[model samples]
Target chain A: MKASDEERRNDAVIIRTEGLTKHYVLGAETVRAVRQIDLTIERGEFVAIMGPSGSGKSTFMNMIGCLDTPTAGKYWLNGQLVSDLSDDQLARVRNREIGFVFQTFNLLPRATALHNVELPLIYAGVGSKERRRRAEEKLELVGLADRMDHKPPEMSGGQRQRVAVARALVNEPALLLADEPTGNLDSVTSEEIMAQMETLNENGQTIVLVTHEHDIAAHARRQVHLKDGLVEQDFLNEPVETSA
Target chain B: MLLFEIVMVAMGAVRANVLRSVLTTLGIVIGIAAVITMVALGEGAQQRVQEEINRMGTTILTIRPGQQMWGGVSRGDAQLSVEDAIALRAGSDGLLKVSPEQQSRMQVTYGRYNSNTQIMGVWPEYFEMYDHQLEAGRFFDQGEVQGRRRVAVLGYNVPETLGGTPPELLVGSTVQIRGIIFEVVGILEEKGDAAWIRPDDQIFIPQSTAQYRVMGGRDRLNSIYASTETPEELDQAFAAIDGIMRREHRIRVGEDADFNIRNSADLLETRNEANQTFALLLAGIAAISLIVGGIGIMNIMLVSVTERTREIGVRKALGATKRAIMTQFLVEALFLCTLGGLLGVAAGYGASELVTRMAEWDTSVAPEAVFTAIGFSAAVGLFFGLWPARRAAMLDPIDALRYE
Candidate 1:
């Protein structure tokens, strides 16, 4: 194949979901948390999935992050189908391909920032010297290189969020999945974190961010808004430069 | 990145909860120490009993008559005669001493002092046979028996009844047995009683003198004391004497015997059996504590799993495999157990020493007990550790991540 054709062929289509659904039985009631949905994402695409509370945005993010299996659907990542993967296989895929940023910045509380960032590499069987080098580089990238030895509890909310971002990017995963990444931060810290995420995306990283705010979703080129477990709209945002 | 990361995490977890880990380990330590100390007690008791039995000496046998039958129809009386004693000594290959004894209670008198005591008629060799030694004066001699002399040897206690005078001073002094004046020849040393009579409180006279003057020349004798050259020939001596007595009395094989023979070997065997029983009991009690310690490990591990639920979720969400989670918990459990086990071994040694000092008893703590105690504690850890590790591994990452 030609190099451009091969680049397109191997362009890291990270998430492809068809008829994805999640149903849970509580007592006698069967609740469908996420209805049938089809979605596709390509290499280096910065996309935002927006939904209000109980709109199935979190459930969809979990499936896309390989933390949960779809009840009935075909989900593929990097040309490999993931819908039928076992728990162990899913864990391997999650470690190698997807990095997650939770709303609460889920870094281990008692662990140092370096240890937290080294976690993915440790799980991926990376050697210690290389794990340390990569972890340090990622922390430097997130502008927290001097705080590598500090624990999560020792850092501020903004600093902790940045450490979590460094951890997410350490493995050089194909996609970064952030679920309400700035929900717990103050407005200024939230803006700072959003700017960091923007810088990461500009450096040729794919990002699928889940958020409820329109302003947060507007930071990305493409936005998909969900209402009541169904996609309400899918459109590109107007260019920020033209609007200014 | 590999299994070592989980091990390091476990180490970090233990380090963070140092007090809790130490307390948990203490439970196992106590369990192991209890088991070890109890076993040591049993072993010490066994050794003490055996030593006590051995201190009584060997090669000494006691014979008593068989029970009387209805209408006296048994093989006459079981009375051991002087004739039988003499025949036993002459026929036995390694016989060192043989004496027939007759006992009777009577008033013994010296001047104004009078005391009722058991009188024993023993041959000259009886002094060395039962390890009896002279404090003052000498035991009766062969010439006294040949002449049928009325000479008595006072045991150490009998001198107290005679106003505490030396036996030599009392030697030519007259002591009347049943109103007959008998010259005191020797005094025995203060050897305490066996199972029955006190040797120091008894009075000894020549067999011939007691036979003729004391017992009125009756043909029947009460019992016999026989001593072999050494312990090795004791059984042979017993068999030889039994054979001579039976033949002299014209008793055939399979006929009812006239006497019963008892030896120190029987007492020794009984002491050994009791020791074995004690050891078994101690081991059983120790095992109970070990089981209890194991349950404690299980309880603590369960609590740890609950406490670390969020950590597990975060790791799982970060792509940690279930095997990694399981190994983390298992290593933690093992570490706790091994630490407790080592401390327990030290505790056992100290406990044994304390017991030995406080009670004045012998307590020997063997190396095997230390190793076994530690191994048992670790096994307990492994056995109880599995459930909590599995519980942590089986956690659903989605539910765990959302758990408060």
Candidate 2:
């Protein structure tokens, strides 16, 4: 088959969900957390999934991140259909493809910044020498080279988040997924973290960020807003530049 | 993940909770110490018995008066006489020699010191039969026994207690047995407890002298020691002696024999068997503590799982499989048990030493007992740690992450 430009463009899409739905049976109540959602995110594109507290944005992000399977419908990542994958298989996909930056900056409290970044590689069965080298490089990338020996508790909130970001990017995952990455940081630190994200994206990395703040969502070129377990709007933004 | 890595990680977790881990291992330590101590006690007893057998020949037999029970109401042991000993030797084949013994508690004095101790009166053949060695002077001969002379052989400790005089100096010294002056002819070597006889504290005199003078003339003998040349002749020699005793005592046939002829080797064998059973029983009781120890590990591991739920969630989200989680907890349990087991071995050594010093008892710990104690602790770890480990592995990651 001769591939057309539009077809080739669609081929670049890293995440595509078709009629995805998730419902939980809580005792006598059936809560539909995510309703028939169809979305497509292409490679090298920065996108923000914006939603309020009960809008099911977190649930949808979980599906896209391979953290949860859809109750019914089709989902694909890097063109591989993963909706039917087993729990263990989905974990492998999450490890190799998705990098999570949690709202709370879930860095292991007892580990050094360098060791925290080395975790993904350790899970990937990398040797100690290689793990150390890659972890150092990632720590250096996030401008925390001197702070590599600091533990999460010992560091400032901003530095700890930066350590989390370095950990997220160390695996060279296909998509950087951050869920309210700046929830615990002050406004100034939030902007500093967004700048780091922008730099990574500018360097040809794909990022999908989940946030409730309009300003934080505006930093991405495209935004998808959700309401009541369904998509409310999808649009592109000019990414109005900000000064720190 | 590598096995070594899992163990290292598990050890790190265990080390982080130092007090709790050590507390969890306490039961295992106690269990292993009990097992080791019991085994050591049994072994020490067995060794003492063996030494006693060597001092007295294995083929030797002690003929004590048998119990006379009428309708299960015991009338105590019957009395034996020297006539029985003489008659057995006269009517016996495969018998080498016999010694009739009679004992009495008496007060003895030498110089300005005095002590109360046992005096054993026996024939000359008794010394050779018991492998008794003299430290100084000579043994009383049959002539002395027949003449009812007042010569006596002092035990090695007799001099040390009476006046602290040396063995050679005690020889030719006159000591009063039952307030009657008897000249010390020989000093016996320091032989410890053997054949249920404490030879180091007693004085030995001729049986004729004891029967006629000390007892005011009585023919009754306390016991008889008889032996054959070889171990193989033991059974036949017992039977011949039994016949002699029966005919002398004039007990009717098919009736309960008046005397009990027991071989030294048989007694030793029975004692060794009883010691084995005692050790095994003690170890079995001790193993229950290890099971209790394993349960402690499980309890602490469960608490740990709850406390580290968020950590488990993070690990699961980082691509750790259920198998990895299971391995981590299992390794943690095994580490605790093995650590406790090793510590218990050292404690058991200390315990045995304490037993030897404080209680004046012999205690020996065997290598096999140590190995078995360690292996049992591992089995306990595996057995009781299973449930908690599986519970940790099966936790839902999302729920765990959201857990407070």
For model 1 the local lDDT of residue B5 reads 80
lDDT of 1 by residue, B1-404 (tens): 48778778888888889998988877788887777787677667756665544444578776667754434486455677888778877777546477888888889988888999889988887787777888877888878877889998888999898777766688768899989889887788888654354788999998888889988887577877788768998778778767877797666776766777777555456546755665567567667767777788888899999988888888898888998889899989988898888888888878888988997667787778778777888788899899999999999998888877
Poorest 10 consecutive residues of model 1 chain A by lDDT? A3-12
DockQ of predicted model 1: 0.60
User: Once model 2 is optimally superposed onto the true structure by TM-score, how far is the C-alpha of residue B129 displaced, in angstroms?
Assistant: 2.3
Once model 1 is optimally superposed onto the true structure by TM-score, how far is the C-alpha of residue B311 displaced, in angstroms?
A: 0.7
- Residues A35-64 of candidate 1 have per-residue lDDT tens digits of 888887887788999988988888888889
Measure candidate 2: CA RMSD: 4.6
What 10-residue stretch in candidate 1 chain B is worst by lDDT?
B68-77
Report residue B133 deviation for candidate 1 (angstroms).
13
Judged by DockQ cut-offs, the docking class of candidate 1 is medium
Measured by TM-score, the strongest candidate is: 2
Off by over 4 Å in 1: A1-11, A241-244, B1-3, B46-285
